[model samples]
Target: MLHTIKQYFNRKGLRDPEYEFLFEPYTGEEAVSFDCETTGLDVHHDEIISIGAVRIRGNQILTSEKLELFFNPQQEMRVESIKIHHLLTCDLVDGVPLEEGIRQFLNFIGNRPLVGYYLEFDVAMVNRVLKPMLGITLPNRQIEVSGLYYDKKIAAIPQGNVDLRFDSIMHDLDLPPFAKHDALGDAIMTAMMYVKLQHIKYLEKF
Candidate 1:
């Protein structure tokens, strides 16, 4: 585990202490908005089935540069999970092996900060595979869209913070509604949220 962690830090360019603060005061040329679909929600027990991400630059989502991958999980899928991600065991027949999926995901993300709603879980799932399969971990800085939305709301209205639910934020921002539970759809929603949050005046100051 220690070796894996060390290797991850090295691979992600997170060896520098300053890198820890990279996502706090967001300043960057590009940021990758990400989301994932999993077999279940328990990070300790469940497994990731698919991952999707899109890079945002200059207030635009670079759709042409998106990354989407289906992963073969070591565990069997729970029936309930199918309602969410729509990935049945049969659907994953062509899924990539864990190591290849991790490597592709890492290559896609590179050193850029990762953005997602509830990102820690996705990061943990990725780490689970990386540490065991490749003796590495995912070390990229993470930005949670939920937190960003809450911060933006607080800044906009000094009275009180609003709920960070995805639906709430989408309704508030007037973003086009889409069916949830799909990785690509969620990633696109996250990208839209990130753009909308950036336009918030108080958030722009930072």
Candidate 2:
């Protein structure tokens, strides 16, 4: 864990004493399932349009308490990107600035372990904004839902190939589908997946 933290800082060209708290071990019980809607796929150029997350305490997903924040990205919306998330510049005119949006997200998540389908991309987009403001990427540990599903599946069928698609996983687990391409809906669905995966006998034995 320490090695990963050092590598992240070195790659990002950052050094800060106050941000060291992020490297400490996480002892909390809560985990946040999060998702981000961005302008495009290029992390270096695209900016976040929204962030949604829900918290899980043990096996329960606290849907009542969730973060759904929108931001005004000062960039032209791509036609393809607009088709994916359906948010245009005009739709985000009244949204908060990136700085305020990020601050609120950080406050909502704190040090809780983060869970998501493909978390690295989301984390990278978040860190792109956070590195400049906080001098650190997310300090919280991240748990990929795909990884959890893979572990459980491979255990059940040692030599069988596993399907890791979001829809496939949800279907296999008997979970209902939620609205895709929407941050809040996706976050809640991901949260549900995490809770269910935790109760699997294979995971419980470990």
Candidate 3:
């Protein structure tokens, strides 16, 4: 099934070679900001309910190029998870099947590096689906905004060491207000942080 999907994409001229990052100067153009809402935080046991992503080029979000997918989970959703993402099982009537959603997500991402908050877990959930269904792993580089903010802060403030909490970064950076755990809201916040960090990087260089 996965092979046929890949072949279809290839036939449509959608397959691109993987990206190689040389030891060159950094630029913000080649990044895709993404976020996932799941049935729970446990990547080992929980399931993804929906995913949203936007490609950021030159510090601008290409809204027209965004990808949004809702996946029907194999497991039943816990009450707590539904309260968080608001995706009831009944709400997923139009959602794509898990396999098809994964295939579309993989094709949308292609070889672009991913940007998100605590990205490893999302990547793990995505790979969990792929490894079983497609017999392949996710093949994109990832950048965590949480880690990047921490590194930037540690470099900027040598004397004041502070843990990098999401709320802390949001407050410190004067980022826009957001709903605590909404997938699309988080994705937009992550995109905003990425753009702000690029400006900070530029300042440090100049």
Best by lDDT: 2
In candidate 2, list every pair of residues with a backbone clash: none
Better of 2 and 3 by lDDT: 2
The most accurate candidate by TM-score is 2
Off by over 4 Å in 2: 1-25, 202-206
142-199: candidate 1 lDDT, tens digit per residue: 7888888777767767776577787878887778968766887899888898888787
Q: Total backbone clashes of model 1?
A: 0
> What's the number of clashes in each of the models?
0, 0, 0
Cα TM-score per model: 0.80, 0.86, 0.78
Question: 73, model 3: CA deviation in Å?
Answer: 2.0
TM-score of 3: 0.78
In Å, residue 108's CA in model 3 sits off its true spot by: 1.3
lDDT per residue, candidate 3, 1-206, as tens digits?
88656534433432223312211224445677888888888888998889888878877887788888887777888888888777887887688988788777766766678899999988898877766665455556678988878777767666676666776777777787676666666777888888898777512220
Question: How many backbone clashes are present in model 2?
Answer: 0
Q: Could you tell which candidate, 1 or 2, scores higher by lDDT?
A: 2
lDDT score of residue 156 within candidate 2:
74
